[model samples]
Target: MRASTPAYTMSRPMSESVAAIVNDDIISTYDLAQRMRLLIATTGIQPTQENLPEFQQQALLSLIDEHLELQELKRVEKDQKFPIILNDQEVRDEITDMASNNKMTADQLLASLKSQGIAEDTLFQQIRASRSWEHWISGRYGSRLRIGEDQIQATKARLVAAASKPQYDVSEVFIDAGRAGGMDAANKGAAQLVAQLQQGAPFAAVARQFSSSSTAAAGGDAGWISPGEMPPQVDTALEQLRPGQLSQPIPVKDGVYIIYLRDKRAGAGQTLVSLKQAAIALPADAPAADVEAARTKLIAVRSQIKDCATLEATVRNTPGVIAGDLGEAETSDLLPEFAEAAKTLQPGQLSQPIRTKVGLHVLAVCGKRAAGAAQIDHDQIENRLKGQQLSMISRRALRDLHSTATIEQR
Candidate 1:
């Protein structure tokens, strides 16, 4: 069956409060309002008339960009006539995933849409378009991209190093910053609770009884997180704590935090075997000699790296380098240049220097396993690869679409 028109258009005039036009499609003010509400709720931003206008304008521009992308995707689909398509079950599954990410059940999310004056069918239609676009893009571009065994090995090696580092399972108590008297009361209460914890009071019990965050119900558990994943102040406190220690009250931009280190575990799992590497870029207007000098330095750095460990250590020590353990890069996670370099290395080996738009890279091979190494599932790998590729392509496509779109605000 053909997908239905957006819900707002079905019962209302298409011309009413038209925000922008993308080809034949109209982005109405009603659509912008619903999107604004969703963005505000997700970002935890307090809504006000002052900010609402800005939000509405931004949302309308974003919608136009998305429409342009869908139009391009449709053009591709028509040209290729690819047999791959998202069935109704797949569409429903996508909706379920969206709901889960938002911490709501599918029914609850649908009800929330109703509260925002957005019909459930409208959202379903949007989901259909999104899924179809994904399908078309993957079918068109999947084969041209190559991710190899060496790339996965390098990623795995980095993950191993990361696992060797210390980690914490933390719990937090949050108090909303926007509420009147909220910050002061939460700060004082958290300070007292921290003192009580220092005096050996039960942390989880205190958290369950008093925290304002939804995680309070779960004893304020934030789950396992890396230092960079947390706010800087909170990260600093966690840095000083050993496992099973509790931190003093810390103020984040929007809340008060009292954290407890529940446990520590060594990273030795498939999940920890992922790594990401991006070639460092020189300034846009850099002198040719300076760019060449940087490239030569990167080559020298790559030449000394014998494995992922050395590569990671070198990047860590280098002033201008950023590297990460992506926990098992599939072919899709790698840039084309990196993937090509990865294809040449064995485990415990490093590749020759390769140039990309960013700069020069030396991809070091960390480890390799046959398709089912360490009990990693093939289907899981394929899905992860697909998701990563889709994200990269989508972001690029959206940027290009935005560049050409006409946008105005009232």
Candidate 2:
């Protein structure tokens, strides 16, 4: 037989100091504040007065989810003889790992956290909650998990392809313009979020608070993605970044997206290039006169262009024209349309006006280079696939738990 759940209660008229009530647990303003501190200490995102309210709001939602996780663990363990507890060494190691990420020693991290009035107990408790949730999942479903040879081989092939091409580990802050509001309201909200993000607010924290996507729960991490997987706008944005770059807010059909390029693969089978480009904006609905004007400008300059340096200087004299000195980049990273046209250009040769999502671009080849076959690692690929599978399984289990649980927020 199952233990009885606590009775539901009305939310008290909320104050700025009060966070939320989770079943019988009172997640107070103090808890929220401490959690925010923990978030910064672990993730290295500094807090600000401007982004504080939204950060707290996001923290509160996480607390609510944590509560759900805890509640489910408790219900499942009612028949257990002992409460769940994590090893102290594991907790310490986690803290050490987090400190290393922030370029601090474990003692320094502890001192810094203490200086900010945050306690080690807070992190310890969080670890325990997460571990308990993991335990619950393992007990319920771990027995069913198996990694077959076919899955490993498929993952290996994908990784080889990734190493051959370009891939990114990206984190996003997505605003669901479709349901949150119309595009006008969406863009405004997205712009506000982007501003806050630029002002030192952590991308993950903001995503958990504000994003409507499922990935928001994990701080809007979009994991490893190939080129075509992203929306057209996002894919375009990705092309313009290196690892650790933060992109401006991009409006797509459904929502506004802001991304941090956490990482990318760089190795063999890579074709790198440097190019100079002259471009004119041909808006999707541009008048014929404007199109012809840009066309005339591109053609007139085509013969005069010599090296990339000459084209860049000359494009300055032409009105409504912009030139690019795209320093060495992977050929795969180039805009798809530009990459094909660029492939045909010899050193010191110019391309005809190439149609891109942005506009018409005429390119000059500065230089190009390519690396040999990729150095692939089948073991790492297998591990990544396993991790991905486990993550999906964990999410599915949590969704099941949430669907059956009784939750109300203030």
Candidate 3:
């Protein structure tokens, strides 16, 4: 069946307001403002009056793509006859977690945002876009993503041969020099993204919002890269950077690049781990009693962890929790609870109750083993490669949207 005209129409004015008319939905001016405030709050970017306008310009770029992603997702869902929706409670939980991380309660967070004239739904939608895109990518690309045993063995063998040649942890934010308006537009976009990064908007967030590359799906993570994996110019920039330093916009033949150096590692391989875990999620919109009940159950389970020995069975006792093998992972692989848990736990240990926007998480560390320069996990490598491919697919999808849609900025 052909996709129906979207439930929304391009010509109709949104009651909330519109900054741009996407294919059938609107990017409200309010979205841009709230996102700017959220960026400032999350990234520790102070919105000095002088830099605020600069931030706004880049925020719009991010939102434009967000609209495109949602629109495409809608079409994909309809044509494929599957629901493409992000849970509202999950969205609330993300906001709640963000507030907690900043040492504020969700209500206090909302109040603070309102004081700054930011809309609550704007932040909610941003989180929704992020979560939904991740789901779409993983679901859409799970089957075709490739990493054969021979491929892994080859990569591992190559690493073994290299001996001490270091792998650099890298992330990127890209601007297409090949855009229709050409280098001038690309450079301008790159400059705006760089300024936002300097102002404290995260590189990943900025990249996801602005990058023309496929890595935007994973927030521009290029992952652990070998010496020859990148072009000479990008590699050269990598050599000069210490971890946490982001590069200036470097010119490539067809791309403008901003690279973030994450780290460099040797033996025990950045202290990575592989995990199998489960969680029982309480509704983010639930009453206090329900949330506390879930938390209490989580804490009880956490206390019972003698070791990773029986974590799988114990985690599944909760109604909504299901155990899944997460394969091999780095500390950077997960968000707060699991990531922190992976970092601190022994090989068989279980982490304490880590509250997330989604639910109370009890993580089990299935294995924590050293990864030498030559060692690689098949499942993990497959996931990483798949992520890269998904990003590319998403990029192509958005490009199609740009070519076909009408976007009018007011």
Candidate 4:
């Protein structure tokens, strides 16, 4: 799992070779090269001399996991006496969707990869393994899980309590040691992922493909989390991070985590307001008489506009007047003077003329959502709960497979 491994570890260097062995299956050197190309192509990681070894190691690791998963799928089918065959069309459909997401037709996508020296069959095989595993896992386990109202209420209560505390908007990439076959492998994989991230790879794309966390489906977006919501190591990492920063791999009991701090907020329960404004253009150095005239003109226009809907029309009729629709934002995001005026106004109420360097302006409060007015998303909560459970089960399943299987890394 370390970078000490040779970049080329071919048992037979004279011909097509094997990177590793998973039970009876051989992961070919050709397979490793194709997967590395795919990883770089999809994640946009800038390949370099220093990072190429890491990429090779990670690609071989991924290929081994896929081999184990495909073997398990077959074993389960044979034991259960059910038809668990992964339909060819399913894999093709997934490829088509991938192509569409990249703004290409299926044939065009294949041609593009071909031009880049990647085989079409390599892509199909990877998709087939992934689709097979996902279908089996979701169908077998997802249908059996049930969430109760008590659980939902408990989660909602926690959210409400956390609303009073500072929250972080974060994304993550988790490498499960169990799934990776050991702590060393997980750590190395996490480091490789970070290298790609640092080199401009898209975090979401990488997370969906590599992270074993429940949030992987959401591009690792762990939104608006307060203290004590994450693991102790993760919390410590977050505490030291400013917005738009990435954390180095943090080792934990089960795996390693990489955190990306997207943003931070004082709290979640801040008041949100929607506003509209009418302004009369005037220079700051204008004479006192001119300022008064602009203020006087704005006051007259404000009287004619009973609410936000009428403000724009009133501004249109008055020359030199401009209207603006300031969309919803937290009160803290607004200017201090504007925030004060907004706090005093109710929906549909107009503010007194306020003077700024740009002009004399009157603001209308379109709407306000009081602190804690945000609704709890029941569906989102349920999905999160289910995803967490599924992620745990998946790791255990893969771990068991790893323990029983014969694996050899060249």
Best by lDDT: 4
lDDT of 2 at 325: 85
| Local distance difference test scores for all models | 0.60, 0.69, 0.69, 0.80
Judge candidate 1 at residue 272 and give its lDDT.
17
> TM-score, each model?
0.46, 0.54, 0.59, 0.67
Write model 1 residue lDDT over 274-351, tens digit each, in one string: 333424676567688977787777766666555566567767767676565545565434777666555445455656
Q: Which predicted model would earn the best TM-score?
A: 4
lDDT of 3 by residue, 223-308 (tens): 77777666778878887888888888887887788998889875344545777666776656768787778778777767765655
* Residue pairs in collision within model 3: 93-357, 214-391, 214-392, 308-348
lDDT of 2 by residue, 1-410 (tens): 22222132223335645457766777877677778877655544556676565456556666776787877677656768555434566666777875687699988877777787777666665766666666666655655667786776555444444444667789987776643447776677677677766777778867755676556657889787766656889988998999988898898987888889998765456655678888898877777787778888888877677777788788888888888787767678888987886666645668888866568888887755444433334455555555556656776666676676665555
By TM-score rank, best first, the candidates go 4, 3, 2, 1
Badly placed stretches (over 4 Å) of model 3 are 1-18, 46-54, 79-81, 97-108, 176-182, 192-223, 242-245, 262-374
Evaluation by TM-score, superior candidate among 1 and 3:
3
Candidate RMSDs in order:
17.6, 18.1, 18.3, 13.3
Superposed Cα RMSD, model 3: 18.3
Give per-residue CA lDDT, model 4, range 1-410, as digits (tens).
Answer: 11122122223335668778999999888778889988777667788887787678767877988999989988888899876655556666788988898799988987787777777777777787777777788899999989887786677557655666767889988988876768997888788778778878899888877788878767888777777878989988888899999999999999999999998877655767789999987888989999988888888888899768788887899988899999987788998778898866766679999887777889898866546545546687798788788877876887788889999988
Candidate 1, residue 324: CA error in Å? 36
